[model samples]
Target: MEKLLTIKDVQEHLQLGRNRVYQLIKIDSFPKIKIGNTYRIPKREYLEWIQNNIGKTVFL
Candidate 1:
């Protein structure tokens, strides 16, 4: 099974706030899934995105 991350998890992992995470989610390149009203991020894809976008400043 794939590991899933919640908004709070993303916040902690990225050292960002809740609203910042939500803002990132609005960006087209952000890797996220919306199920009902909750947002879930796939750990693998999130990590991949980070690796691929290293040094790129994400403005949100």
Candidate 2:
């Protein structure tokens, strides 16, 4: 099983602000899951997305 990351984890990982993290989540291709009112990102998928989207702006 893979780890699921919270918005704060993502903010720390990407060195982004809370609003920026939420903005990224709004992008259609971002790897995320919604559980109730909380959002969780799959660690593996996020890592893969990083590798794949290197040098590209992810927020839309």
Candidate 3:
């Protein structure tokens, strides 16, 4: 199975606040899975998102 990352992992990796990570989760394009009350992000897609958004605005 592919490795899944929690919101906390994403926050730590990106050095972002918890709320910011949660905000990203709300974006349809952002890769995520909702299990019960928790959210999981795919590590690979998260990395790709970082790559694709480098030097670009994350929100319009």
Candidate 4:
């Protein structure tokens, strides 16, 4: 089975603030799983997200 990551784990891995992560989720750019009031992201999905965003700048 794939590893599941908590919000905190993702924040640390990406070196981003909680609010930033939440914001990303709001924009649907970040992959997230909502379980009750908590959020989780699959390791594979996270890796895929990174790969998909590679070399893509926010400001064009």
The candidate that achieves the highest TM-score relative to the unseen native structure: 1
Residue-by-residue lDDT tens digits, candidate 1, 1-60: 999999999999989988889999998888999999999999999999999889888888
Reference-based lDDT, residue 51, model 4: 93
Lowest-sum lDDT 10-residue window in model 3:
51-60
Alpha-carbon lDDT, every model: 0.93, 0.93, 0.88, 0.82
- The parts of candidate 3 lying over 4 Å away from their true place are none
Per-residue alpha-carbon lDDT of candidate 4 for residues 1-60, written as tens digits (9 for 90 to 100): 889898789889989899877777675677788999988899999899889899986421
> How well is each residue in 1-60 modelled by candidate 2, as lDDT tens digits?
999999999999989999999999998888999999999999999999889999986545
TM-score of every candidate: 0.93, 0.92, 0.89, 0.84
Q: What ranges in model 2 sit over 4 Å off?
A: none
Residue runs of model 4 more than 4 Å from their true location after superposition: 58-60
Alpha carbon deviation, residue 41, candidate 4 (Å): 0.3
| Per-candidate total of colliding backbone pairs | 0, 0, 0, 0
